[model samples]
Target: MKLTVTSSLLALALISSSADIGVHANTPFIIEKSPVDITLFVMSRCPDAIKCESTFSQVFQAEGLPEINPTLSYIGSIDETETSKTELDLSTTSTTTTTTVVTKVNCKHGPLECAGNTHQLCFREFFPDYKVWVPFVTTMNSWQPRRIGESAYAREVAERVLGLRQRRVRRFLSLEEEDAEEKKKELEVLLEKVDECSEGQRGFELLVKSVQNTLDHGVGTSCTVFIDNKKRCVVDGGVWRECPGGSTVADFVRSIKEAAGKVFRISW
Candidate 1:
């Protein structure tokens, strides 16, 4: 018989199927090896989002934590009614074709916010590892409101965090210039990928997909966290709110550990 896993009922069903009720001391133990899945929904320029991510940054910084894989999603709306199009025509052949293009996406915080969202999506795409991308995002969020979508600001932040600027400054003074140059090249390549992604149509597509996921999940809040496919917490005004399961770093750590689930087998 096949069983569908949901809540604690799966545990009950497993226990009832065991043949050796109390005869065996060593029973087959099952343990979940999968990492916890966490999804964060946020608007790039929202203060609430900043606070929420800052809290999560602390969670990540905690020592001796379980494996937690977090994904970032954006929240916004797209206006399909308002669009721009490109027309391609061959005058001699009397053939014409038109293609509709997405000019802009409407964000609650306005165009700069939209741009910020796109850049973040691009960053996540290129740097999927939470360790690499999370701090970069947190730094961006900590920046002033005026710098939210500025490419210059983003470039400078990337340089500072990735140590590209320091590498450049040391290239002239260091004894091992070749090593420094190689390191600079690697960082520069990744930064170039981010720039290309954020400035192209692919960035818009990623932003739209992220927004759609937020809409599909019916998440209207600026900062909402989902763990193991369930709503875990919300942070607004720099405080935890709407967290039924508790809202401390320890609370989140406990949830993540429990979310690993359990597995066992009958020993007859």
Candidate 2:
């Protein structure tokens, strides 16, 4: 039997099937429903995204995943449009015609960012296990904003930076080309073969829409944390100058220190 994986569905259950996705394939990164749910929606290239990702790496490592369940994802998708063109040559006695595919893309930082965002989304949606997903995020963010173009460079980034092999990062940019339908099948197991990649689109869009779905935007910040429609915490402001409280990296660190001091006092 085949499983239909959806964000809503996956949040409810994790596919226990053995699938190799990350450097640490032994760890499971399943998203279990817990009292605390955190999602950080930001542009792929935004500095705030980096801050949020970095902060999560530090805090999660110190406090563990259970203390602060975080979902770091892009806030937009690549707009895909296809147009067919026929060109005729009437030079000789016989006429020859050719049809071509044209694709246009607009990403937050550029095409590189779109590619990076899609790869991250693919991992989160399909290959999310603690061993694979967590390491991928922490490592990729550490060396991210890579130069645009080529899956080979991405594979290199994975190997050298994340210590992942070739096949491990193969699907990272699997949905880059125009034929997303075919690529989705080759990339994700549960998806059906079709003319377009509805499943992939949904996965990408779900994260994109997460920004509007939460109170993060109200605070004018990228890595703001929200729980039950309430603003919890946020990294320093990125583009939005008015983003509240947090400003620089040190400000965030200071806030942590303050919180820890309060905890120490309470403990005493």
Candidate 3:
């Protein structure tokens, strides 16, 4: 899936989404003031990706942290030579729909890994709040080797995390306002919307764009960490190495705060 110079340009053309000067709607939203852009290149089914994301989750959840823009770029290979189109069909008991699209991207794990990647992307699209989707993805990464790529498992974990969030909000609600049955229905609806996106044409488009971005960045390895568009660290063979500043959570927090200070002339 290595991309030559010609194939790289072709891969960029496959993206149907708009490309603004410095704006990407599909990627995570960056805070305008003092934001540190952090992108993690990963594969959904890779064990190293799980370990890398889990470590960064700790960094993100650390108390009294500055504004940080976190994004995930899935790792895959795009082959421009393939001209044949593959149809993605998402069928249910009541209806069936097919997405006719040609994707040259090939994931390292398998087709299931591609589906899992799309599921995470859909979750990020449906729930933009990092607090919600980040933890949900981290939890899903925990359920690896067995339930990594199953659609049912994706829905199950989404409900589980969404319920946890709803309960936290429920604690602030008055007893009269708390309706458990109504909350259950709302959760079901939200899950259904995400499921549709993950199993439909939008999902395929998202994956293609993600893989295109990965290739554009020349990210060939899983668990590669990029901060401020520069390679900062990487997790390979389940271990962190080649970190210039340091790989510890404290080191990353310090680096981010330093970067923020330089960007905004304010200390954290």
Candidate 4:
């Protein structure tokens, strides 16, 4: 029978899943007990920044961490004539558009105002769920970095909060195949599919290799499933590492559970 996965179940699965690395009583990262202030610097048009804000907001709401006061900043236009430039050779028939946008314009205080504006819009677009600490403004040249430093501290707190949220999501979405008979059948089918796919001359071999590597080196440690500086998904040692490139969400969830099973030892 097909089981329905709910958000609550998913959250629970994330929380209850055993980590390959044994859980220690001590926290690795220090999160201040009090609320932290944060400033996020972003570009209005950068998708990476937008994703970061969205993910962070999800995590923030998931974990009831202390109240955070965050400021979002955007980098504005820049003068191309006054700045150094690099040229790239392109094929005449290339269809790709190579448009360069200058973020820093002729502002006296540099592009701080532009940066703040861009960041503000990005936060609004991506993290509408979270309460915005900074309102939309044309510029913020007088913005202080010390505020941003505090905001960074708040961001650290948000990470831990998100972990708790992830746990809830996992639990809410856990599959109910506890019986040995059912589990064995599922495993056999999965194995058969793997074998069948491997025998074909498809490009799935590389993916299989990556899964195998993750099984070997990914357990009991914080593995980054996807990371692009600003955006990342890290699976803690005890948690399952979701497949980085799964064809479907279900496949991705299965991969994470499988990886966790191989690496973790469950404890109360």
Give me the candidate number with maximum TM-score: 1
Per-residue alpha-carbon lDDT of model 3 for 12-131, expressed as tens digits? Answer: 775533455236554555435567888999999998999899888999988877888898999998765524444445563354444544556689998889888999999898888888
* Backbone clash count, each prediction separately: 1, 4, 0, 51
Off by over 4 Å in 1: 1-32, 82-104, 168-177, 262-268
Across residues 80-169, which tens digit of lDDT does each residue of candidate 4 receive?
A: 433444555576644443455443232223333233332333323433434432222211112232222132322322222322223332
RMSD (CA, angstroms), candidate 2 = 18.0
For all candidates in order, the CA lDDT equals 0.79, 0.48, 0.81, 0.35
Worst 10 residues of 2 by lDDT: 190-199
Per lDDT, the best of the predicted structures is 3
Choose 2 or 3, whichever is better by lDDT: 3
For candidate 2, write residues 1-268 as lDDT tens digits: 2355566577555443333334347655544333344466655566777767765556545432333345654554334455655555667556554555443334557666665655555555544544455565566666645542234444444344322343433345444445554543454342222112223565345444543343334544566654333455665654424335464545444444444333311110
Question: What is the Cα-based TM-score of model 2?
Answer: 0.46
Among all windows of ten consecutive residues in candidate 3, which has the lowest summed lDDT? 168-177
**TM-score for candidate 3, residues paired by index:** 0.74
Error of 1 at 37 (Å): 1.1
Q: Cα deviation of 42 in candidate 2 (Å)?
A: 1.6
The segments of candidate 4 whose C-alpha lies over 4 angstroms from its true place after superposition are 1-34, 76-268
Ranking by lDDT: 3, 1, 2, 4
